[model samples]
Target: MNNPVISVQNVDAHYGERQVLFDVNLDVMPGEIVVIMGGSGSGKSTLLKHLLGLQVPTSGSILVHGKSLHDVSKKELKQLRKKMGVAFQGGALLSSLTVAENVSLPLEYNTDLDQNTIDIMVRLKLELMNLGGFGHLMPAELSGGMLKRAGLARAVIMDPNVLFFDEPSAGLDPVTSVELDELILKLRDAMNITMVIVTHELDSAFKIADRIMVLLDGKVVQVGTVEEIKRSDDERIQNLINRRPRSNQLHGDAYLQRLVNGEGEK
Candidate 1:
């Protein structure tokens, strides 16, 4: 493609002796929504950390806007990170701070804006998340869904070009999860921001992904649109999409029967 906003080239990540990601390569275009999906221990989150520069790659390189993480100076990395926003899995907010305070934290550290400007910015972001008057409320006072929304508001407060969401639908009820998915779509369309979502929720993945990357055993098994994935003939892809039990899938007919029965019960 032309110039991807984020690119990963043969990235391999390791934690001590354990290899976490193996030769992962992917690219995210500007204004696109890409979903990374896989089962637990598939290295989806590990890959996300690499993308965010929290964890360095053992081999290969990660680039944001064409600048390699390893090549960038610490000062440059800090500035580059400010250009992106991240909504963690559980809305990692400050327990002691109010909603507005949390939202303004980034501006406080990254900009020279005065208090009045910061307050206005906070209000704008909170209002965008449909949380106009909840600014004064503590994190404990907000519900789980509200907390997620508040965290999203904070994430976008700096008007970042890229937004990273780690399991946005986790810990949410079905209806709430759907609402959050819609919100993600709206953000992409209305704000023209590139979004990278890390999620294992198949329904949510199919609902929001413009492109899907499936990770397995610390490697990318497939990367394509949802339809392409659905039509894939790869055994690993099929098993994952069909929700077959991993251990039993290698055993043949009896396991297939169990998978059929289990899916029917759902």
Candidate 2:
């Protein structure tokens, strides 16, 4: 197997005094689609932030293309980040810009290409994303599915080697969600891009992932192929897959202490 394109080792993350990720570790190989999945507050988004160098891990390290994000100089980090692209959950387009302008922003900021050349390139990407003729429309005019595709088009404008997608199927109709899934698979196949997708959608994960890493309460419950995950007998994994709520029996003293002190109790 090829070396992992992205690696996370013993990562621990915290927000203020609250710990969100605990000794989390994973690797993403070149051209592989690895899905990080869990329900709300599972630390999926935190892990994504770490991977993108948006936030440093409280402890541990994240390596992108064999370079430690924490150890790299700012210029080096910026260069390294050029190899990565992120499609945020909300599409994250500039409401003020037209669709074509939004998609071309990365090139405008990062490159000195002439207007004609940039326009040509942007059109090609938009066409690939099925938004070729809609470039004149503003973000407010696009449907949910179109917005997602537009965000995706912008994410790939730099031809990044790694793509980080957050909730790709979120906030869309079932048919549109399926279309987005197909588009994601197609993007992987056509571009050979390594993907780390953060999603709580089980069906979407199963459909698009080469492997799935299940996170529960800031820890990895399991990392396996789709079939292996489906066959696992872990109670937590089963509960998540079956959409059953975890039953927690509260210890009165601990609950009372936490409530009074504003701290967590295990």
Candidate 3:
């Protein structure tokens, strides 16, 4: 990855005494779409939080555009955040604000731009997202897919260099999910933004990712192109792709011990 936009180096994360991520490492290049995929308890969420600078790693470092985040000042971190954008899984829109107002919130709080300029920029982004006329509508008035699009519009409103998404296709129908995948590809290309997505949705990841990073048991199991992943002979990878239920012999005593020791919490 030449001129990588993100670099994670031997990162290990912990929750209390239990380590959740084990020596994770990856790099994301400019204008590329990288998907981080794993099932529940795979430590994907922990990785995302670390990348967003919401938590510090217990060991190792994360660098965004060559700026180390482990011990950066708050002001410096805020400047780095200004170059990043996130589309949460829930489409977290404020119910009281109109779509246009919601979309304008970033520019309103982050810049000295006036109402007229913010509104114009908001409309432009909404139009780019295929929601130009819907800006006047409330978030409640939007369908699930439309709401996701609205969220995407707001995320890219700042023209961020790195865009992150969490489960962008979680609740939508298949067709809607596919449509959103297309929109994601379009946004990365048109805006020249590096996209990092975390999801359990295999189809969407396979369709949209330039490279896929697979995780298991708090460690990266594999990182490969879509075709390479399909060709993988790893049983874990094959089981995940096939959605095959496992008959792992987890003894009842071990399960009880985990619960007794409070090790079940993620």
Candidate 4:
């Protein structure tokens, strides 16, 4: 049996005095697409930071390809990160650099390849992302969807084994969002890359994910296939899926007490 490509065990995270994640656990197999979905404040971003080793969990451990994130030496961690690629929300391209330069940045920094080889590699990725002719343009010249493709080109420039995408469909129109989702599936099929996407776009998630993991109040509510998630009996899960607003319940005395005692943070 193949071991999981990514394992997160009993992770707990906090910010100052407030806990953000609770006993979060997940396993991602090689070449799998796992979509992590949650409302804002559900610890999705915090969890992504932990997965990328940008932040250590307060209580548990994370392993990528079997290497403990916290236990690895700095050099080892750097090497491990070479196998990982992250495409942040909003594209995150360097405004100062042209698209080609941005896409070539990874190869330039990580390899001793000559400029000729680097240019060829950059062209390949740009073409893969359908940004071939736009490479000469600055980041500012691109539209939302083009910027996202440019970011994705930069991310996969290294031919990483694992890819992490944050909100791939966040700001795009419906057509563009579907196009990006199709591109995501194409990349996975062609490259055999393991992917972990953080998104709340239900249609996109259902289309692209092999499995969907739902989070609520900083804890996992369910992790299952799309059909299973749709048929879930959990009220919270149903509420989230149906886009039903949470009912506001009165906690008059408790709320008043908390207000007086300054314990209202929840």
Candidate 5:
């Protein structure tokens, strides 16, 4: 593949003393959906924070467009971040703002566009998210699934080159989750945007990911296409994919140490 839009190399992250990501290396090719998945305490959230520049890795580095985020000037970092979008889990909408206003906030703050133009642009995005005519509704008025779509609309409102989604399928009914997955696929197809998704829904991961990275206890165990992962012989990979319980012996004192370090055992 061409040089990745996002490159993570030998990244080790820590919460105080407890390392959460151990020498994790991955790449996100443009226009591909790469899902980072694992159970709780797997460190997927930490990886996402690393990507978003919210947390610094204890070692190694993350590079976007060949520029390392480690120690970059704040001005440069802000500009780099402008090219990305994030749809956080739980909608993350402001309780005080209407959907149109929430989506318009980015353009209003980031651009020189007039109110009329911003309004038009926000409406266009809401329409693209299949949320047409619902722009005036408050987040509280929408269903769980509609809320997700609204969040997506806001994320892509700026036409970012890279989009990151956190647990897009979480807490929704199966049908709603499936609908969100389809919307994810459609976004990639229509916009050709690079997508990094963090989710544990096996069916959603299988359906939408071009590649999947499975992390376990702060370490990356496997990274492959859906078929490759499904056929993986790694016992942990099998346990995860098959929805089998982790062996208690496997979750021993090492796990406890990791938990004690900072990431408490779940």
Candidate 6:
């Protein structure tokens, strides 16, 4: 690859002494959408935190544009961070700030642009995310989906080269989740920005990902395009893809038969 925009090289993360990610390796090429999928406690979010530089890895390294996050000084790290945008889980918008103000926060801190210029930029981004004229509304005033759109507008305010999203479809209805997936695709197509999305929604993952990386037990179980994954013979991948209940509810007898026969699950 020609210098992937984001690179995770043998990354291992821990919470206190308990390890969360184990030797995780991945990359996001420029303008590509890479989805990380896993069940709860699989460390998908932890890996995202490492990518966002919120937590230092216990071992290995994470690099943005080939510069290791651990090797950068505080000032350099801040500068590097300014080149990226993050849409945290649940939108994470400031309830006190109006949507416009929330979107303008990054601009306010990272640039010396005048108020008028910032206002224009904020409006432009809001419009891009289909939230036009709603910028003056408080986060509490908007719907869940709108809040996510506003949060996305804020994330891209600086036109960062890399964008990170956590659980983009959480708590939304199916229709709303599909809409968000479309918006993700639109942003990538229009801006040519590299995107890394953390999600467990299978439908959303197959719809939006150029490639998907399935994480399990703090390690990558499989990584490939949607078609490849769909045709995979790995038992764990099949179980996830076919929506088969392992420790959960069983779907039907046929599914159980397939599981026993190893048709999809190798």
> How high is the CA lDDT of each candidate model?
0.92, 0.94, 0.92, 0.94, 0.92, 0.90
Clashes of each: 0, 0, 0, 0, 0, 0
Question: In candidate 4, which residue ranges exceed 4 Å CA deviation?
Answer: 249-266
- Candidate 6 lDDT by residue in tens digits, 165-191: 999999999999999999999998899
Off by over 4 Å in 2: 248-266
Ranking by lDDT: 2, 4, 5, 3, 1, 6
Better of 3 and 6 by TM-score: 3
Residue-level lDDT of model 4, residues 1-266, one tens digit each, is 99999999999999987899999999999999999998888888899999999998999999999999899999999999999999989999999999999999989999999999999999999899888788899999999999999999999999999999999999999999999999999999999999999999999999999999999889999999999999999999888889997666649997788788888456
Q: Per-residue alpha-carbon lDDT of model 5 for 135-210, expressed as tens digits? A: 9899999999999999999999889989999999999999999999999999999889999999999999999999
Residue 244, candidate 4: how far off, in angstroms? Answer: 0.7
User: What shift in Å separates residue 258 of candidate 2 from its native position after superposition?
Assistant: 9.4
Q: What is the lDDT of residue 119 in candidate 2?
A: 95
Q: Write the per-residue lDDT of candidate 1 for residues 186-215, one digit (tens) a residue.
A: 888888999999998899999999999999
TM-score winner, 1 or 2: 2
> Lowest-lDDT window of 10 residues in candidate 2?
257-266
Q: Give the C-alpha miss distance for residue 124 in model 3, angstroms.
A: 0.7
Off by over 4 Å in 1: 249-266
- Candidate 3, residue 252: how far the Cα is off, in Å: 7.9
Pairs of colliding residues, candidate 2? none
Worst 10 residues of 3 by lDDT: 241-250
TM-score for every candidate vs. truth? 0.92, 0.94, 0.93, 0.95, 0.93, 0.91
Q: Rank the candidates by TM-score, best first.
A: 4, 2, 3, 5, 1, 6
- Our tally of clashes for model 6 stands at 0
- CA shift at 220, candidate 3, in angstroms? 0.7
> 230-262 in candidate 2: lDDT tens per residue?
999999999899999887767999788879998
Candidate 6 residue runs with Cα over 4 Å from true position: 247-266
By TM-score, the best candidate is 4
The residue-level lDDT of candidate 2 at 131 comes to: 94
